[model samples]
Target: MSTITHRLPQKRHLVTELPGPKSVALAERRQAAVPAGLGSGVPVYAVDGDGGVLVDVDGNSLIDLGSGIAVTTVGASNAAVADAVAAQAHHLIHTCFLVTPYEGYVAVAEKLNELTPGDHEKRTALFNSGAEAVENAVKVARVATGRDAVVAFDHAYHGRTNLTMALTAKSVPYKHNFGPFAPEVYRMPMSYPYRDPLGDDGVAAARRAITAIGTQIGADGVAAVIVEPIQGEGGFVVPAPGFLPTLAQWCRANGIVFVADEVQSGFCRTGDWFACEHEGVVPDIVTTAKGIAGGMPLAGVTGRAELMDAVHPGGLGGTYSGNPVACAAALAAIDQMETLDLCARARAIGEIATSSLTATAALLAADGREVIGDIRGRGGMIAVELVRPGTSEPAPDLAKAVAAGALARGLVILTCGTYGNVIRLLPPLVIDDALLREGLAILGEVLAESA
Candidate 1:
């Protein structure tokens, strides 16, 4: 087996407090210069990172299970990506794809087209972020279908931009007071197996969503139906088995473009190239980012060639849409994912994490303290939902404590869910076995402490 080699030793070592003197000083400076709207998970500054550890400004080596919110799938500080970035930077910084075309952009587009779940002739448009990719996908759908109404799902998180904010479900931080959002976006029910009134019957859950779309919006009036194959920030809510296929078939029958928002679930993060392939359902359009460029800013919208090319010349692209450096990083990251076979790595990590979490849950239940409502997710993207003992009521407070406690103990984690009760674990795919187990053990310890 070809094991991935790390540049930095994979271990956690906290020298000073989490927000040490230097970080605290930087925080004070940030308070004056930066916007208060930006929230920090640990309030520490990072100077270096590799494998699964992020070295803070205070010299605290913390095990990184968040992966910069799943952006650094190859590794936090990938040498291949850095080399590609530097080589490209040494040539030209930006010529703007609109002004002068570059092969790096075309190469990335070709890679996305070849990898994005279908053999059909495909076209791609690159963007600077996930939100832009999603927005452009919607635009392509509307233009192709000649319809204005787009349907999004409950518990879905598309992005933070105006159109995507309309697609997102949560309000407090992502969408609160940030609208008059874009018009014509409708919310439908998602096949959230945990909380669905249909009781894990995915066919019925999908039927309800399809019925709502047909009755409320009229199938012919809808331009697109967008959903995350596995909801990320809305909680790692893996839909029941039959939900996605049913929706895809229904969209095909209705001529509505079916979009898979794979921003958080793509590039071998979920033990697959794309999460939609787990069910063998191919989307008409796909939005990808997060794990694409190994921490560089890049996103893509890939779809059927006819639909993407329907837009006239000069209809798509931005100044930095496919910056040379970003494209180079993306190519290198894709190579790393392939050479390392991170898909298999993700599945192996999933088994290890699931076993540890399941054991912890059983131990808690043995003590009559069943605070974990559920432990679910695939591959490297896993989560545990905290709930009041013996009840389904969300325990956001408990989740918050678990996160804070983990950070203090030198393990970095994150929380999500509409109710804010999910602790998501997203370790880098190249994490060493011992390091991964050690990090998960810290998580188990934190949960036990909460119990």
Candidate 2:
């Protein structure tokens, strides 16, 4: 395999204590200026990033495993993306696709329609964020199907918008005090292979969800069933093998639009273009963000042409929807993905991560420190669920400790899940294998130390 290095060198170098003096000083200003609600995972402030390393103001070069929540799949400082964005800025930054109708916007839409699963006449609309894409997808589904209710699964995270907040499963930070959310939204059981009470029978799990939807909200009343093939934020939960296909099939039979929120798992973050592709489950609408524009704020909802056209022209648009510069970045990022064959790279990254994490779990088990309850995911979008030793109970404390430990050692990592017990690893797809392994080694060592 060829090594794809970014602008920054592929190595970890910590100059001082984490949140060194400069970072600490900046923190004081941030507390006074930035709102408390805007929380950061790591305290340090990044001045530059490239390849798999984020160089902070403190001069600490931390190995990036989070990828800015899986955004920079082409690397944070990708040359192609930078060049395109710069050129676009020099030409025209924002013409507003809704008004001026730029070619860059149309180009991105065409790409999304062509790239997303299924060739059955797809249409795409670009947005500023995942939440907007999801909201628009729901709108299209409701208008197309003429149904009022939408179904979202357990542990699913759509976004922070008011409508998406209602669709989200967790409450604490995302939905707390954000009451009176959009109504007519219903929740159903997810096929959580590790934690499901019904075990890992994919078809049976699908049946359970279908039955719940029927009892709670009839099929005729439901417009869409939105799901994340690999649940993000709720934990990197990969459902049993056949769970997604069955649910999608049922949605089709019921005339409900199946929307796959691939915000975190789309692009080459997963081995496939989208996680739904792994199960051969083609969603009526697929929401994409994060990795779409190589750090530029861009998201897209690609769906069936008929459904997309069902909505009136002015019904779906935002002032900044499909910004020209972001579109240019996206086009360049897509080019990089194709030229480098990032899909194959993602699969290789997954293989390495799964093997390394599995070995770490086994070692911990042999030592009677079974904190790693599960290690699951596809491609670079992998996570390790921490639990109490020899038991299924969540070990959130251990998970936090592991993340902190890794961060302190100049290895950037992120933790997520409803229970806050999952440590998710999302290194850049173009990251060098040696650096990737180095970060994983640090994570494994941290886990061992915690045990």
Candidate 3:
């Protein structure tokens, strides 16, 4: 079971100094070809990836703990997904779902509607990216409710589009000089236990966000309340227990369409098929992407039938939305997930991560190094929040150094959060146990050395 299918060895091997001569030359080419705004986390260029390792251009096999920012949850080269993609590509790639609707797109929508929370009659619209899904979700909400105001929580990351930028709270990187963003998007206090004064009391924190919504945005005017089931990019912040439920209930009572942005925390990345299930919150609209199509560019907006049907006949859809090839890949990915029981695998991975990180933090503390401010998340999506030693102050610099150190050791890790102080572990669910631990050990050593 520990030996996940892959052509390359599952061990971390560094043959060259990070960006070897070949990678250095490619970097020079990339600097000239690619825009500076687009950044890469790992220094080396990837040639192939499967199972738990990424083979770089310089013959270095780096352990991939980021899963390409949580997109390749089924691994980079699942045989089934590849075969499906190839079969579909051989037949028909795209005919424009709108012009000549295909069964693949309809089949994917049917699957999404069936899988998302709640057994009630649901519908789904496919799109190209998470931002596009989010934007359309809001569009559906506003059209159905006839309201313009929308409420988003703090530390929320819907996407990078103009509307999503307004929905986001962080500024420097995501929102810097990108205004004037879409108007009528209100930010509410999220149930952030680590940073909130309320501590672990999720009920009270929900109350705070609800009150702010009523006073600041006028709940009556709100078309939707969009939030990440487990905030990704915004530090992997999991709202305290009872927090999401309270907000969902409030939205229900106020006639607001509760939109759960599960773009990053969906598709078994958080143990459950969807992170909102952790809190038993059935959102009115669920935005999905990232791990949806086995790295294929596909997004979905699943919601109540009435809300989705409210839009005009041609209101939703794009030229490449739900491309046949992507749908085929999604189908095979779903088959692999169900047959392999990836949800259970994710839970097992979560267990290992929580135990290892907690033990490592305790050991570090015993040595008088207390940089780990918090450790949180479920399933394979774990986060280690770094803080100043002996204090709760955020330490972004320390987080950067730790990630860089791990990269030097041939482990590809990712750091995220509004303050950029959280190291998030998003290994593919198919990662072998030994490889996952080896990656964890490298991260632990890097953090310890950073102290």
Candidate 4:
């Protein structure tokens, strides 16, 4: 019922400028220690986080609208998760689930099996990151189907691993100079409602992709069709209604595994346990992370038992897979999510964000600014796609400025998309309504000023 935990004030307060003296010093230390490849969206250094605010090293409390990139949905300081992690660390941190199979790991698998879409008998394997989960999911599909080729959609972002890089559509930062990527990966069109070449017919979009896969990669040779139920890095594009269903149906009909990369859209962040539930389209495999362990490093691939079990026992585990402490955190996080009914909370957040963003878009349009070309997403995962003043051309610079402005005003936001023109809002599910409203209001003000 509270926004801030640890007795930290819930309200966003700026005691000093962002990246103040202490934070600037820490940034210098970070630059000396951390690799340049790892980029930080916000320059400030955080020392504490609770509820919806991140308290920086300089004592500036910034409202968290990004949820640590959607990984802290239960808030950054959930008592349940913190207690479980501490208790588990005291008992046993790691025996590598593969080496000494812990009950916590099994319990997490059970939870994922029950919560993910569909009633079919399911099994789950834990991994260390979303990229690992995706790689494992593809391994399961490939082994199950005995096919080598996989199909991914445009604007899709799977991961940074070589296989995932091949699966990803964007090349500049994600895939550039990372090749030669995994071979036999095919790219197909997604059912992007905003950029649909064939109007907004989900069925037609599916047909287009299906036909292309068959013609280009031969559907028979394709092992899986992997996609984000609602494209995440691809501008939070909520595909046209029926789009996922049609794709799922096609995959089933063609013996191709339909894998939903719910890494960013899962775990009640999308109003449901999984985004696939919105369209009632059950994926053959679902890869999840980022919020699965309440900010802990954990990921999972849950899917039908037949396909999951198809992988040879030794073929599936990593040294750190399902670290006992992370397993404990996941279990506790899951408990908190269900008890708090974060699904409904996400829905409520979605309503607020979408309404506010849509209203802002309307206002901008009325003023002929037209910076916000589209607003879409589900549950707590929402985004505003910025475009040029009068055209649909992406305005990535404007998006950057708006995020910078919000940051300067003690608000933390994240921007992502293939073209980098999307301002995504993924607040913690447990955030207080008042704080959430304040953050959104700041976003509106920033947009208005930027326009």
Position 431, candidate 2: lDDT: 86
Off by over 4 Å in 1: none
Instruction: Please give the ranking of all candidate structures by TM-score, highest first, separated by commas.
Output: 1, 2, 3, 4
Q: Compared with the true structure, what per-residue lDDT tens digits does model 1 show for residues 11-101? A: 9999998778999999999999999999987778999999899999999999999999999998888999999999999998889999999
Q: Which residue pairs collide, candidate 1? A: none
Alpha carbon lDDT of each predicted model: 0.93, 0.93, 0.92, 0.91
lDDT of 2: 0.93
Ranking by lDDT: 1, 2, 3, 4
Q: In candidate 3, what are the lDDT values of residues 1-451, reduced to their tens digit?
A: 2334676678888899987889999999999999999988777899989888898888999999999999999999888899999999999988998999899999999999988999989999999999999999999999999999999988988889999999999997898998999999999888888999998899999999888877887888999999998999999998889898998999999899999999999998898899999878899999999999899999999999999999998999999999999999999988778877888999999999999999889999999999999999999999999999999899999999998999999999999999999999999999999999999988888888997
Quote model 3's TM-score.
0.99
- How would you encode candidate 2's per-residue C-alpha lDDT over 32-68 as one tens digit per residue? 9999999998999999999889999988899999999
lDDT of 4 by residue, 242-318 (tens): 77898899899989999999999999999999998998989999999999999999999999999999987799999
Compared with the true structure, model 4 gives a TM-score of: 0.98
| Total clashes for model 4 | 0
After superposition, which runs of candidate 4 have C-alpha atoms over 4 Å from their true positions? 1-6
